[model samples]
Target: MGNLDGKVALVTGAGGMRGVGRATALKLAAQGADLAITDVRRDASDLPPAEVRQEWHSIDSVSDEVEALGRRCLPRYADLGISDEIQTLVRQVMEHYGRIDILINNARAVIGRDKVPVTDLEEEVWHHFLDINTTAVFLCTKFVGQEMVRQGSGGRIINIASNASKQASAMGAAYSASKFAVLGLTQASALDLAPHGITVNAVCPGPINTDRMSYWERSQADAAGVSLEEFRAQIVEQAGRATPLGRIAEAEDVANMVGFLVSDEANFITGQAYNVNGGLLFH
Candidate 1:
Protein backbone atom coordinates (compact mmCIF):
# COMPACT_ATOMS: atom_id res chain seq x y z
CA MET A 1 0.00 0.00 0.00
CA GLY A 2 1.08 3.57 -0.67
CA ASN A 3 2.11 5.93 2.11
CA LEU A 4 -0.63 8.45 1.32
CA ASP A 5 -3.33 5.92 0.78
CA GLY A 6 -6.84 7.43 1.02
CA LYS A 7 -5.52 10.97 1.45
CA VAL A 8 -6.55 13.99 -0.63
CA ALA A 9 -4.03 16.57 -1.84
CA LEU A 10 -4.58 20.01 -3.34
CA VAL A 11 -1.80 21.36 -5.57
CA THR A 12 -1.73 24.77 -7.21
CA GLY A 13 -0.10 25.85 -10.51
CA ALA A 14 0.01 22.25 -11.71
CA GLY A 15 -0.62 22.95 -15.38
CA GLY A 16 2.84 23.52 -16.77
CA MET A 17 4.46 20.54 -18.47
CA ARG A 18 7.86 20.77 -16.79
CA GLY A 19 6.88 22.55 -13.57
CA VAL A 20 7.35 21.32 -10.02
CA GLY A 21 3.63 21.39 -9.38
CA ARG A 22 2.93 18.85 -12.12
CA ALA A 23 5.72 16.59 -10.94
CA THR A 24 4.63 16.84 -7.32
CA ALA A 25 1.04 16.02 -8.20
CA LEU A 26 2.04 12.90 -10.05
CA LYS A 27 4.39 11.84 -7.29
CA LEU A 28 1.73 12.26 -4.63
CA ALA A 29 -0.80 10.40 -6.76
CA ALA A 30 1.58 7.51 -7.15
CA GLN A 31 1.64 7.32 -3.38
CA GLY A 32 -2.17 6.85 -3.44
CA ALA A 33 -3.43 10.37 -2.80
CA ASP A 34 -6.38 11.81 -4.68
CA LEU A 35 -5.48 15.19 -6.17
CA ALA A 36 -7.10 18.55 -6.78
CA ILE A 37 -4.90 20.32 -9.31
CA THR A 38 -5.31 23.95 -10.39
CA ASP A 39 -3.76 26.41 -12.82
CA VAL A 40 -4.39 29.89 -14.27
CA ARG A 41 -5.14 28.12 -17.57
CA ARG A 42 -4.61 31.09 -19.92
CA ASP A 43 -1.59 32.49 -21.67
CA ALA A 44 -0.16 35.58 -20.08
CA SER A 45 0.30 38.38 -22.60
CA ASP A 46 3.58 39.22 -20.86
CA LEU A 47 5.19 35.92 -21.88
CA PRO A 48 8.20 36.11 -24.16
CA PRO A 49 7.57 35.92 -27.92
CA ALA A 50 9.00 32.42 -28.07
CA GLU A 51 6.92 31.29 -25.06
CA VAL A 52 3.79 29.75 -26.41
CA ARG A 53 0.65 29.48 -24.30
CA GLN A 54 0.20 26.19 -22.46
CA GLU A 55 -2.46 24.30 -24.32
CA TRP A 56 -5.77 24.29 -22.41
CA HIS A 57 -5.17 20.58 -21.93
CA SER A 58 -2.45 21.05 -19.35
CA ILE A 59 -4.49 20.42 -16.17
CA ASP A 60 -6.58 17.80 -17.92
CA SER A 61 -3.41 15.98 -18.85
CA VAL A 62 -2.30 15.93 -15.22
CA SER A 63 -5.71 14.67 -14.15
CA ASP A 64 -5.50 11.88 -16.70
CA GLU A 65 -2.15 10.84 -15.34
CA VAL A 66 -3.45 10.85 -11.80
CA GLU A 67 -6.40 8.69 -12.77
CA ALA A 68 -4.06 6.37 -14.61
CA LEU A 69 -2.28 5.90 -11.30
CA GLY A 70 -5.61 4.75 -9.83
CA ARG A 71 -6.21 7.88 -7.77
CA ARG A 72 -9.07 10.36 -8.07
CA CYS A 73 -8.36 13.74 -9.73
CA LEU A 74 -10.19 17.05 -9.71
CA PRO A 75 -8.97 19.66 -12.19
CA ARG A 76 -9.82 23.30 -11.54
CA TYR A 77 -8.81 26.69 -12.95
CA ALA A 78 -8.24 29.51 -10.47
CA ASP A 79 -5.89 32.44 -10.01
CA LEU A 80 -4.53 31.85 -6.51
CA GLY A 81 -3.42 35.49 -6.28
CA ILE A 82 -7.05 36.54 -5.91
CA SER A 83 -8.58 36.11 -2.47
CA ASP A 84 -12.09 35.37 -3.63
CA GLU A 85 -10.88 32.82 -6.12
CA ILE A 86 -8.83 31.04 -3.49
CA GLN A 87 -11.84 30.82 -1.21
CA THR A 88 -13.87 29.35 -4.03
CA LEU A 89 -11.10 26.92 -4.84
CA VAL A 90 -10.92 25.53 -1.28
CA ARG A 91 -14.68 25.14 -1.23
CA GLN A 92 -14.62 23.24 -4.47
CA VAL A 93 -11.88 20.94 -3.26
CA MET A 94 -13.72 20.19 -0.02
CA GLU A 95 -16.95 19.54 -1.87
CA HIS A 96 -15.25 17.20 -4.27
CA TYR A 97 -12.90 15.33 -1.96
CA GLY A 98 -14.51 15.86 1.49
CA ARG A 99 -11.15 16.62 3.08
CA ILE A 100 -7.79 18.20 2.33
CA ASP A 101 -4.84 16.32 3.82
CA ILE A 102 -2.10 18.06 1.88
CA LEU A 103 -1.77 21.51 0.34
CA ILE A 104 1.08 22.43 -2.03
CA ASN A 105 1.07 26.19 -2.54
CA ASN A 106 3.05 25.98 -5.77
CA ALA A 107 1.49 28.76 -7.85
CA ARG A 108 3.76 31.79 -8.25
CA ALA A 109 4.17 34.99 -10.27
CA VAL A 110 7.31 35.80 -12.27
CA ILE A 111 6.86 38.49 -14.90
CA GLY A 112 9.67 39.19 -17.34
CA ARG A 113 9.35 42.94 -16.75
CA ASP A 114 10.10 42.41 -13.07
CA LYS A 115 13.55 41.04 -13.89
CA VAL A 116 15.06 44.51 -14.39
CA PRO A 117 17.46 46.23 -11.99
CA VAL A 118 16.11 47.83 -8.82
CA THR A 119 16.57 51.31 -10.22
CA ASP A 120 14.26 50.53 -13.14
CA LEU A 121 11.69 48.53 -11.16
CA GLU A 122 8.13 49.83 -11.02
CA GLU A 123 5.95 49.98 -7.91
CA GLU A 124 3.33 47.82 -9.59
CA VAL A 125 5.91 45.23 -10.47
CA TRP A 126 6.96 44.76 -6.87
CA HIS A 127 3.36 44.55 -5.70
CA HIS A 128 2.53 42.09 -8.47
CA PHE A 129 5.29 39.73 -7.41
CA LEU A 130 4.41 39.96 -3.72
CA ASP A 131 0.72 39.48 -4.39
CA ILE A 132 1.16 36.10 -5.99
CA ASN A 133 4.32 34.79 -4.40
CA THR A 134 3.91 35.87 -0.79
CA THR A 135 0.30 36.95 -0.28
CA ALA A 136 -1.16 33.93 -1.99
CA VAL A 137 0.84 31.65 0.27
CA PHE A 138 -0.67 33.32 3.31
CA LEU A 139 -4.21 33.11 2.01
CA CYS A 140 -3.95 29.49 0.99
CA THR A 141 -2.36 28.45 4.22
CA LYS A 142 -4.88 30.40 6.29
CA PHE A 143 -7.94 28.96 4.59
CA VAL A 144 -6.58 25.46 4.14
CA GLY A 145 -5.19 25.33 7.64
CA GLN A 146 -8.64 26.11 8.96
CA GLU A 147 -10.04 23.12 7.13
CA MET A 148 -7.28 20.87 8.36
CA VAL A 149 -7.93 22.03 11.91
CA ARG A 150 -11.61 21.42 11.53
CA GLN A 151 -10.91 17.87 10.50
CA GLY A 152 -8.77 17.51 13.63
CA SER A 153 -6.24 15.34 11.80
CA GLY A 154 -2.84 16.83 11.22
CA GLY A 155 -2.09 17.83 7.61
CA ARG A 156 0.96 18.98 5.68
CA ILE A 157 1.37 22.35 3.94
CA ILE A 158 4.36 22.77 1.69
CA ASN A 159 5.17 26.16 0.15
CA ILE A 160 7.22 26.22 -3.06
CA ALA A 161 9.92 28.77 -2.35
CA SER A 162 13.13 29.31 -4.34
CA ASN A 163 16.90 29.32 -3.91
CA ALA A 164 16.52 33.08 -4.26
CA SER A 165 14.95 33.06 -0.81
CA LYS A 166 18.34 32.70 0.83
CA GLN A 167 20.19 35.44 -1.05
CA ALA A 168 19.65 38.59 -3.09
CA SER A 169 19.86 38.57 -6.86
CA ALA A 170 21.59 41.37 -8.81
CA MET A 171 18.59 42.30 -11.00
CA GLY A 172 16.02 40.16 -9.22
CA ALA A 173 15.24 42.28 -6.20
CA ALA A 174 11.48 41.94 -6.43
CA TYR A 175 11.48 38.19 -6.98
CA SER A 176 14.08 37.69 -4.29
CA ALA A 177 12.24 39.83 -1.76
CA SER A 178 8.99 38.03 -2.41
CA LYS A 179 10.63 34.63 -1.91
CA PHE A 180 12.29 35.81 1.29
CA ALA A 181 8.85 36.67 2.54
CA VAL A 182 7.71 33.16 1.66
CA LEU A 183 10.29 31.70 4.01
CA GLY A 184 9.03 33.95 6.77
CA LEU A 185 5.47 32.85 6.14
CA THR A 186 6.49 29.23 6.18
CA GLN A 187 8.26 29.52 9.53
CA ALA A 188 5.62 31.66 11.23
CA SER A 189 2.77 29.50 10.03
CA ALA A 190 4.55 26.40 11.19
CA LEU A 191 4.63 27.83 14.72
CA ASP A 192 1.00 28.90 14.81
CA LEU A 193 -0.26 25.60 13.40
CA ALA A 194 1.90 23.34 15.51
CA PRO A 195 -0.63 23.33 18.33
CA HIS A 196 -3.15 21.87 15.93
CA GLY A 197 -0.78 19.16 14.73
CA ILE A 198 -0.32 20.77 11.31
CA THR A 199 3.12 21.18 9.77
CA VAL A 200 4.18 24.05 7.51
CA ASN A 201 7.40 24.06 5.48
CA ALA A 202 8.91 25.52 2.32
CA VAL A 203 10.84 23.88 -0.50
CA CYS A 204 13.49 26.08 -2.09
CA PRO A 205 14.33 24.76 -5.51
CA GLY A 206 17.32 25.80 -7.60
CA PRO A 207 17.27 26.52 -11.34
CA ILE A 208 15.04 23.73 -12.54
CA ASN A 209 14.57 23.15 -16.27
CA THR A 210 11.05 24.50 -16.76
CA ASP A 211 9.28 26.58 -19.36
CA ARG A 212 9.52 29.58 -17.06
CA MET A 213 13.29 29.20 -16.88
CA SER A 214 13.42 28.82 -20.65
CA TYR A 215 11.56 32.10 -21.03
CA TRP A 216 13.94 33.82 -18.64
CA GLU A 217 16.89 32.41 -20.55
CA ARG A 218 15.47 33.70 -23.81
CA SER A 219 15.07 37.18 -22.39
CA GLN A 220 18.58 37.17 -20.96
CA ALA A 221 19.97 35.90 -24.21
CA ASP A 222 18.26 38.65 -26.19
CA ALA A 223 19.68 41.25 -23.82
CA ALA A 224 23.16 39.83 -24.36
CA GLY A 225 22.70 39.80 -28.17
CA VAL A 226 23.18 36.03 -28.30
CA SER A 227 21.05 33.37 -29.92
CA LEU A 228 18.75 31.38 -27.62
CA GLU A 229 20.68 28.19 -28.37
CA GLU A 230 24.01 29.78 -27.48
CA PHE A 231 22.64 31.36 -24.31
CA ARG A 232 21.11 28.09 -23.18
CA ALA A 233 24.35 26.25 -23.73
CA GLN A 234 26.37 28.87 -21.84
CA ILE A 235 23.92 28.90 -18.94
CA VAL A 236 23.81 25.09 -18.65
CA GLU A 237 27.59 24.95 -18.64
CA GLN A 238 27.94 27.73 -16.06
CA ALA A 239 25.30 26.33 -13.71
CA GLY A 240 26.58 22.79 -14.04
CA ARG A 241 30.12 23.91 -13.36
CA ALA A 242 29.11 26.01 -10.36
CA THR A 243 26.96 23.34 -8.77
CA PRO A 244 28.82 20.86 -6.57
CA LEU A 245 26.82 17.98 -8.07
CA GLY A 246 27.95 19.07 -11.55
CA ARG A 247 24.42 19.56 -12.94
CA ILE A 248 21.38 21.73 -12.79
CA ALA A 249 18.09 20.37 -11.44
CA GLU A 250 15.01 18.99 -13.11
CA ALA A 251 11.39 19.48 -12.00
CA GLU A 252 11.31 15.89 -10.80
CA ASP A 253 14.22 16.60 -8.52
CA VAL A 254 12.24 19.21 -6.63
CA ALA A 255 9.22 16.96 -6.70
CA ASN A 256 11.24 14.26 -5.01
CA MET A 257 11.95 16.62 -2.15
CA VAL A 258 8.30 17.56 -1.85
CA GLY A 259 7.31 13.91 -1.86
CA PHE A 260 9.56 13.21 1.09
CA LEU A 261 8.48 16.32 3.01
CA VAL A 262 4.79 15.34 2.85
CA SER A 263 5.24 11.69 3.63
CA ASP A 264 4.89 9.98 7.02
CA GLU A 265 8.66 9.91 7.39
CA ALA A 266 8.70 13.72 7.65
CA ASN A 267 5.97 13.92 10.28
CA PHE A 268 8.43 15.11 12.92
CA ILE A 269 9.86 17.81 10.68
CA THR A 270 8.18 21.21 10.43
CA GLY A 271 8.81 24.95 10.17
CA GLN A 272 11.85 24.36 7.98
CA ALA A 273 12.92 25.57 4.55
CA TYR A 274 14.51 22.65 2.73
CA ASN A 275 16.76 23.56 -0.19
CA VAL A 276 16.83 21.23 -3.22
CA ASN A 277 19.41 23.07 -5.33
CA GLY A 278 22.09 20.46 -6.00
CA GLY A 279 24.38 21.89 -3.27
CA LEU A 280 24.53 25.28 -4.95
CA LEU A 281 24.13 27.05 -1.59
CA PHE A 282 25.08 25.69 1.81
CA HIS A 283 22.77 26.63 4.66
Candidate 2:
Protein backbone atom coordinates (compact mmCIF):
# COMPACT_ATOMS: atom_id res chain seq x y z
CA MET A 1 0.00 0.00 0.00
CA GLY A 2 1.12 3.54 -0.76
CA ASN A 3 1.79 6.04 2.01
CA LEU A 4 -1.08 8.28 0.87
CA ASP A 5 -3.74 5.63 0.42
CA GLY A 6 -6.61 7.69 1.84
CA LYS A 7 -5.34 11.18 1.26
CA VAL A 8 -6.77 13.82 -1.07
CA ALA A 9 -4.33 16.14 -2.85
CA LEU A 10 -5.20 19.43 -4.49
CA VAL A 11 -2.82 20.56 -7.22
CA THR A 12 -3.06 23.83 -9.11
CA GLY A 13 -1.55 24.67 -12.51
CA ALA A 14 -1.77 21.02 -13.42
CA GLY A 15 -2.68 21.43 -17.08
CA GLY A 16 0.68 21.34 -18.76
CA MET A 17 1.49 18.01 -20.34
CA ARG A 18 5.09 18.17 -19.14
CA GLY A 19 4.95 20.29 -16.01
CA VAL A 20 5.76 19.93 -12.36
CA GLY A 21 2.10 20.25 -11.42
CA ARG A 22 1.05 17.37 -13.61
CA ALA A 23 3.98 15.30 -12.46
CA THR A 24 3.27 16.01 -8.78
CA ALA A 25 -0.38 15.11 -9.17
CA LEU A 26 0.61 11.82 -10.74
CA LYS A 27 3.16 11.13 -8.05
CA LEU A 28 0.65 11.67 -5.27
CA ALA A 29 -1.95 9.62 -7.10
CA ALA A 30 0.52 6.80 -7.48
CA GLN A 31 0.94 6.97 -3.73
CA GLY A 32 -2.85 6.45 -3.43
CA ALA A 33 -4.10 10.02 -3.33
CA ASP A 34 -7.34 11.10 -4.94
CA LEU A 35 -6.77 14.39 -6.73
CA ALA A 36 -8.30 17.80 -7.24
CA ILE A 37 -6.39 19.46 -10.09
CA THR A 38 -6.91 22.89 -11.56
CA ASP A 39 -5.74 25.10 -14.41
CA VAL A 40 -6.84 28.43 -15.76
CA ARG A 41 -8.88 28.48 -18.91
CA ARG A 42 -6.70 29.00 -21.93
CA ASP A 43 -7.24 29.35 -25.62
CA ALA A 44 -6.04 26.57 -27.85
CA SER A 45 -4.01 29.22 -29.67
CA ASP A 46 -1.82 29.73 -26.61
CA LEU A 47 -0.72 26.10 -26.27
CA PRO A 48 2.83 24.99 -27.02
CA PRO A 49 2.89 23.35 -30.41
CA ALA A 50 4.50 20.15 -29.21
CA GLU A 51 1.90 19.73 -26.48
CA VAL A 52 -0.88 20.54 -28.93
CA ARG A 53 0.48 17.99 -31.33
CA GLN A 54 0.29 15.46 -28.53
CA GLU A 55 -3.38 16.45 -27.91
CA TRP A 56 -2.65 17.79 -24.52
CA HIS A 57 -6.00 19.07 -23.19
CA SER A 58 -5.00 20.59 -19.90
CA ILE A 59 -6.89 19.66 -16.70
CA ASP A 60 -9.26 17.34 -18.53
CA SER A 61 -6.44 15.14 -19.73
CA VAL A 62 -4.86 15.21 -16.29
CA SER A 63 -8.15 14.16 -14.72
CA ASP A 64 -8.35 11.26 -17.15
CA GLU A 65 -4.86 10.18 -16.29
CA VAL A 66 -5.56 10.26 -12.57
CA GLU A 67 -8.78 8.32 -13.02
CA ALA A 68 -6.85 5.77 -15.01
CA LEU A 69 -4.65 5.30 -11.94
CA GLY A 70 -7.76 4.11 -10.10
CA ARG A 71 -8.05 7.36 -8.23
CA ARG A 72 -10.78 9.97 -8.21
CA CYS A 73 -9.95 13.30 -9.87
CA LEU A 74 -11.89 16.54 -9.64
CA PRO A 75 -10.74 18.89 -12.38
CA ARG A 76 -11.41 22.62 -12.08
CA TYR A 77 -10.90 25.70 -14.24
CA ALA A 78 -10.18 28.76 -12.14
CA ASP A 79 -8.53 32.16 -12.12
CA LEU A 80 -6.09 31.92 -9.27
CA GLY A 81 -5.55 35.65 -9.45
CA ILE A 82 -8.97 36.17 -7.89
CA SER A 83 -9.41 35.47 -4.19
CA ASP A 84 -13.06 34.59 -4.58
CA GLU A 85 -12.26 32.12 -7.32
CA ILE A 86 -9.66 30.52 -5.14
CA GLN A 87 -12.13 30.20 -2.31
CA THR A 88 -14.55 28.66 -4.71
CA LEU A 89 -11.91 26.22 -5.87
CA VAL A 90 -11.20 25.16 -2.32
CA ARG A 91 -14.87 24.74 -1.60
CA GLN A 92 -15.30 22.66 -4.72
CA VAL A 93 -12.42 20.44 -3.75
CA MET A 94 -13.89 19.88 -0.31
CA GLU A 95 -17.25 19.08 -1.84
CA HIS A 96 -15.83 16.56 -4.27
CA TYR A 97 -13.01 15.00 -2.34
CA GLY A 98 -14.39 15.39 1.25
CA ARG A 99 -10.89 16.36 2.41
CA ILE A 100 -7.72 17.86 1.01
CA ASP A 101 -4.68 16.50 2.84
CA ILE A 102 -2.09 17.85 0.46
CA LEU A 103 -2.02 21.18 -1.34
CA ILE A 104 0.54 21.87 -4.12
CA ASN A 105 0.81 25.52 -5.10
CA ASN A 106 2.36 24.88 -8.51
CA ALA A 107 0.63 27.48 -10.67
CA ARG A 108 2.88 30.20 -12.11
CA ALA A 109 3.04 32.79 -14.90
CA VAL A 110 6.54 32.93 -16.41
CA ILE A 111 5.87 34.43 -19.83
CA GLY A 112 5.05 38.12 -19.63
CA ARG A 113 6.52 41.58 -19.99
CA ASP A 114 7.71 40.99 -16.43
CA LYS A 115 10.58 39.06 -18.01
CA VAL A 116 12.21 42.38 -18.86
CA PRO A 117 14.75 44.24 -16.71
CA VAL A 118 13.52 46.04 -13.60
CA THR A 119 13.99 49.43 -15.33
CA ASP A 120 11.63 48.42 -18.15
CA LEU A 121 9.13 46.52 -16.01
CA GLU A 122 5.55 47.76 -16.04
CA GLU A 123 3.29 47.98 -12.98
CA GLU A 124 0.78 45.58 -14.49
CA VAL A 125 3.48 43.11 -15.37
CA TRP A 126 4.88 43.21 -11.84
CA HIS A 127 1.43 42.69 -10.37
CA HIS A 128 0.92 39.88 -12.84
CA PHE A 129 3.81 38.01 -11.33
CA LEU A 130 2.77 38.72 -7.73
CA ASP A 131 -0.87 37.86 -8.32
CA ILE A 132 -0.30 34.50 -9.96
CA ASN A 133 2.91 33.42 -8.33
CA THR A 134 2.82 34.85 -4.80
CA THR A 135 -0.71 35.89 -3.95
CA ALA A 136 -2.26 32.75 -5.32
CA VAL A 137 -0.05 30.61 -3.16
CA PHE A 138 -0.92 32.66 -0.11
CA LEU A 139 -4.61 32.37 -0.80
CA CYS A 140 -4.40 28.62 -1.32
CA THR A 141 -2.40 28.18 1.82
CA LYS A 142 -4.89 30.32 3.71
CA PHE A 143 -7.99 28.36 2.76
CA VAL A 144 -6.36 24.96 2.66
CA GLY A 145 -4.51 25.50 5.90
CA GLN A 146 -7.76 26.50 7.56
CA GLU A 147 -9.28 23.24 6.42
CA MET A 148 -6.34 21.21 7.63
CA VAL A 149 -6.51 22.82 11.03
CA ARG A 150 -10.18 22.08 11.22
CA GLN A 151 -9.62 18.46 10.29
CA GLY A 152 -7.06 18.17 13.08
CA SER A 153 -5.12 15.48 11.31
CA GLY A 154 -2.32 17.63 9.97
CA GLY A 155 -1.64 18.32 6.28
CA ARG A 156 1.07 19.23 3.79
CA ILE A 157 1.51 22.38 1.76
CA ILE A 158 4.14 22.37 -0.96
CA ASN A 159 4.91 25.51 -2.93
CA ILE A 160 6.74 25.11 -6.23
CA ALA A 161 9.23 27.92 -5.85
CA SER A 162 12.34 28.39 -8.03
CA ASN A 163 16.11 28.75 -7.82
CA ALA A 164 15.47 32.32 -8.88
CA SER A 165 14.14 32.79 -5.37
CA LYS A 166 17.67 32.25 -4.09
CA GLN A 167 19.91 33.46 -6.91
CA ALA A 168 18.96 36.42 -9.07
CA SER A 169 19.65 36.44 -12.80
CA ALA A 170 19.62 39.24 -15.34
CA MET A 171 16.37 40.55 -16.83
CA GLY A 172 14.27 38.59 -14.34
CA ALA A 173 13.67 41.03 -11.55
CA ALA A 174 9.91 40.61 -11.28
CA TYR A 175 10.01 36.83 -11.51
CA SER A 176 12.74 36.67 -8.92
CA ALA A 177 10.95 39.06 -6.59
CA SER A 178 7.73 37.07 -6.76
CA LYS A 179 9.44 33.76 -6.04
CA PHE A 180 11.43 35.39 -3.26
CA ALA A 181 8.19 36.49 -1.68
CA VAL A 182 6.91 32.92 -1.84
CA LEU A 183 10.01 31.68 -0.08
CA GLY A 184 9.46 34.11 2.74
CA LEU A 185 5.81 33.29 2.93
CA THR A 186 6.60 29.60 3.02
CA GLN A 187 8.70 30.04 6.14
CA ALA A 188 6.17 32.34 7.81
CA SER A 189 3.28 30.04 7.06
CA ALA A 190 5.27 27.06 8.19
CA LEU A 191 5.65 28.64 11.60
CA ASP A 192 1.99 29.63 11.76
CA LEU A 193 0.71 26.21 10.66
CA ALA A 194 3.18 24.07 12.54
CA PRO A 195 1.28 24.27 15.81
CA HIS A 196 -1.74 22.92 14.01
CA GLY A 197 0.21 19.89 12.80
CA ILE A 198 0.32 21.23 9.22
CA THR A 199 3.65 21.52 7.48
CA VAL A 200 4.39 24.15 4.80
CA ASN A 201 7.52 24.03 2.64
CA ALA A 202 8.82 25.19 -0.73
CA VAL A 203 10.47 23.18 -3.50
CA CYS A 204 12.83 25.25 -5.59
CA PRO A 205 13.67 23.81 -8.97
CA GLY A 206 16.24 25.28 -11.40
CA PRO A 207 16.82 24.84 -15.14
CA ILE A 208 14.02 22.31 -15.43
CA ASN A 209 13.16 20.56 -18.68
CA THR A 210 9.65 21.94 -19.21
CA ASP A 211 7.89 24.14 -21.74
CA ARG A 212 8.71 27.05 -19.44
CA MET A 213 12.35 26.25 -20.15
CA SER A 214 11.61 26.62 -23.86
CA TYR A 215 10.42 30.16 -23.23
CA TRP A 216 13.55 30.92 -21.24
CA GLU A 217 15.67 29.34 -23.94
CA ARG A 218 14.00 31.39 -26.63
CA SER A 219 14.62 34.59 -24.68
CA GLN A 220 18.26 33.69 -24.10
CA ALA A 221 18.64 32.65 -27.70
CA ASP A 222 17.33 36.01 -28.88
CA ALA A 223 19.62 37.84 -26.49
CA ALA A 224 22.67 35.82 -27.57
CA GLY A 225 21.81 36.20 -31.26
CA VAL A 226 21.82 32.42 -31.70
CA SER A 227 19.27 29.97 -32.99
CA LEU A 228 17.06 28.40 -30.34
CA GLU A 229 18.50 25.00 -31.19
CA GLU A 230 22.05 26.23 -30.72
CA PHE A 231 21.25 27.93 -27.43
CA ARG A 232 19.58 24.77 -26.08
CA ALA A 233 22.65 22.73 -26.98
CA GLN A 234 24.89 25.31 -25.37
CA ILE A 235 22.85 25.33 -22.15
CA VAL A 236 22.73 21.53 -21.89
CA GLU A 237 26.49 21.31 -22.42
CA GLN A 238 27.23 24.18 -20.05
CA ALA A 239 24.95 22.72 -17.38
CA GLY A 240 26.91 19.47 -17.60
CA ARG A 241 30.10 21.35 -16.79
CA ALA A 242 28.75 23.97 -14.36
CA THR A 243 26.34 22.05 -12.09
CA PRO A 244 27.27 19.26 -9.68
CA LEU A 245 24.60 16.91 -11.08
CA GLY A 246 25.84 17.45 -14.64
CA ARG A 247 22.38 18.08 -16.07
CA ILE A 248 19.15 20.06 -15.78
CA ALA A 249 16.12 18.79 -13.80
CA GLU A 250 13.16 16.84 -15.00
CA ALA A 251 9.58 17.58 -13.81
CA GLU A 252 9.53 14.22 -12.04
CA ASP A 253 12.63 15.22 -10.14
CA VAL A 254 10.71 18.08 -8.58
CA ALA A 255 7.66 15.89 -8.09
CA ASN A 256 9.67 13.34 -6.22
CA MET A 257 10.73 16.01 -3.76
CA VAL A 258 7.11 16.97 -3.26
CA GLY A 259 6.13 13.35 -2.75
CA PHE A 260 8.63 13.08 0.07
CA LEU A 261 7.54 16.35 1.64
CA VAL A 262 3.94 15.16 1.91
CA SER A 263 4.87 11.74 3.27
CA ASP A 264 5.13 10.54 6.88
CA GLU A 265 8.91 10.82 6.73
CA ALA A 266 8.72 14.63 6.39
CA ASN A 267 6.72 15.09 9.58
CA PHE A 268 9.71 16.55 11.34
CA ILE A 269 10.51 18.95 8.47
CA THR A 270 9.04 22.41 7.98
CA GLY A 271 9.89 26.06 7.28
CA GLN A 272 12.39 24.94 4.63
CA ALA A 273 13.12 25.83 1.01
CA TYR A 274 14.51 22.73 -0.69
CA ASN A 275 16.54 23.14 -3.88
CA VAL A 276 16.20 20.55 -6.64
CA ASN A 277 18.54 22.62 -8.79
CA GLY A 278 21.26 20.14 -9.67
CA GLY A 279 23.42 22.01 -7.12
CA LEU A 280 23.18 25.32 -8.95
CA LEU A 281 22.91 27.38 -5.76
CA PHE A 282 25.11 25.97 -3.01
CA HIS A 283 24.72 28.83 -0.60
Q: Write one digit per residue (lDDT tens) for candidate 1, span 1-283.
A: 2399989999998987767889999999988799999988565543423344434366888899889999999999998778999999999999988999999999888556677889999999899899999999999999999999999999999999999999888989989999999999999999999998899999998877665544566778989999766787787778878899988888898888888989998989999999998898877
lDDT of 1: 0.87
**Native-to-model Cα distance after best TM-score fit, residue 196 in candidate 2, in Å:** 0.8
Q: Which ten residues in a row have the lowest lDDT in candidate 1?
A: 47-56
After superposition, the stretches of candidate 1 with alpha carbons farther than 4 Å from their true spots are 44-56, 213-216, 222-230
For model 1, name the residue pairs that clash: none
Steric collisions counted per model:
0, 0
lDDT of 2 by residue, 88-190 (tens): 9999999887788999999997564566678888889889889999999999999999999999999999999999899888888889999999999999999
- Mark the regions of model 2 whose C-alpha exceeds 4 Å error after superposition: 213-241
lDDT (0-100) at residue 138 of candidate 1?
Answer: 95
